[model samples]
Target: MAVNTVGYTSQITAGFRAVELAHNKKPIIVDHLAQHLAGAALHTALADYQQLQQAQGPGRSLRVPARNRIMDDFVLEALQLLQQQQQQQLDGDGVVQVVHIGCGMDTKPWRLQPLLHVHWFEIDQPAVMQLKQQLLQQAGAATATAPEPGGADLGSTTAGSSTASLAQTAAASDGRSCVAPAAADHEQQQHQQGVRFPLLPQRYSAVPADLAMVPLAACLQAAGFQQQRPTVWVAEALLYYLPLDVACELLRSMRALSGAGSCLAATCIDAELQQAHLRLPSQHYFSTNKVAWHFSMDELAAAIGAAGWRMQGQPQTAAQLARERYGRETYVALYGGAECCFTAVPG
Candidate 1:
């Protein structure tokens, strides 16, 4: 992939969300924002993904939104529990942190901010983050809330300010913090259209970094991630893109950075499906784009366990989630059983 290009998978994921939102009768997620951000990429990605699903079988396409909904539920549950725990600990409205690893055009903060109050951190490849920022600016999401004077402030509350302050202390020499740069003049000008995205400046931090090369903890800390705070780490559709060792270390780092009452949610192909069904199709379908599935959920779970997280339950396949919970027959046995999502908490 070109260095400037945000690559294909992120666009594809956004496209999948857009397609699901527009087409499905009972879509697992309702995300008009995804459609907005996806823009023209939606058409091409939809066509390509649909073709892949046709080759893979029916219901393959549904996996995207199903996994999304499942992960969304896990994070929401964690946020509720963590928020309550933190409130009790601090004797006030407690702050919980939600970190999205390799976040690529994700709209969770926009979707959940009104329902929950928490600090949001997004980390991703520089190219991907740049594209997302540009999209947000275009969509007027970045400038919905006016920045404080001098423009260093990035949150709407004291919790947001305090986190940014902590990040500034740690990264003062680098001139980076949990705070985002001031919006451009044009973006600020457009904000008057009564445009708003759910996450205002006060609680959202977007950091651009290549996780493989940088210290993940430092990147997050510099973005005002409080290690002692209860956090929910979301690594949706991210582990498979990384090499095995890198993925394992990523889990270890998450575990290390987390404090009490922390949890992790992730989705990946299990080793069995990798051997049973995905091995051939992955190469046939994804190789040209340079995308590859690296580690399975079992491998990831082992790493999670070693890193001090206990599995909440057996990993459930997308097919299983769709069939059992939603009571829909969106099952494709060939590859569906191989794709799985799971949640874990600190042991």
Candidate 2:
């Protein structure tokens, strides 16, 4: 069956990373968490500022103004939390390994790479990865322009002129390094005569097999994760739809795969979530078969404890973040923070 996903939130991941980069001084793995926050801030601020005309409930009239406030508030809160976490682990081996599970179109790999220079990997369903590759290739092909040399202008074919050519060549080489997709598309169309994209051409090698069947511990071992150093496992807006047993197994896997210093960051739904938490007046909006797992904080904490990991300080709730960080008036009347963040360390 096909999955209905939040195509809008897909881009927010990169924005989250940018927010983290701008606000958090420490380094772990720059994922889209930052950009996500900033977008929330900007968007929520707008909602609050607008004050939508829809009447939601007796006391809950839907308003855009409230949405903006909530988004701004939580983003500020997340950034501060991330900054603290970064500093806590910075002086270590600096061998950061950030694994963005089910990572969408985030640019932490690109932006964070130049700054912290850490090893990063993006994991998702094969199709999503293919999309990423396509998008990246297109971006690479289109924005391949090289910067001009710093000289005022080269005069004559002197030794300096030779240096200019060398500089231009180096710049062009760098531009080619990332390979934007637009350039590739042009080439593909040129060679596109009489050729059609194959249908059902091949089956992918299903590694770790199915999510339901895979032994998490063994799979982690196979992936060289059991003993990897400086690993920070991140599951952004993932893990709600997983069965409770499977979720526990994943926690155990996190413990078994990570060494003493490994950390985990994930987002999950509240245990006692109400329909109001959905926040959208249009009850029929957003796909119903989506990933809001609705696990309680108590249950999640218990699972983490069982897996031999210690909880890090403070919990960040989407709702609490908005009201406290930006002010209650910044968000939409219908929009509330339904998700939250947690970080844990191995015991």
Candidate 1 regions off by >4 Å?
1-6, 48-61, 90-93, 113-116, 143-193, 200-202, 272-285, 331-337
- Checking candidate 1 for backbone clashes, the offending pairs are 154-201, 155-202, 156-202
lDDT of 2 by residue, 203-259 (tens): 011111233554544333332232544566666666665666777777777677675
Least accurate stretch of 10 residues (summed lDDT) in model 1?
A: 155-164
Q: Could you tell me how far off, in angstroms, the CA of residue 202 lies in candidate 2 after the best superposition?
A: 32
Off by over 4 Å in 2: 1-94, 113-117, 141-226, 271-287, 290-292, 319-337
lDDT (0-100) at residue 146 of candidate 1?
32
Instruction: Estimate TM-scores for all models.
Output: 0.79, 0.52
What is the RMSD of candidate 2? Answer: 14.8
lDDT of 1 at 132: 73
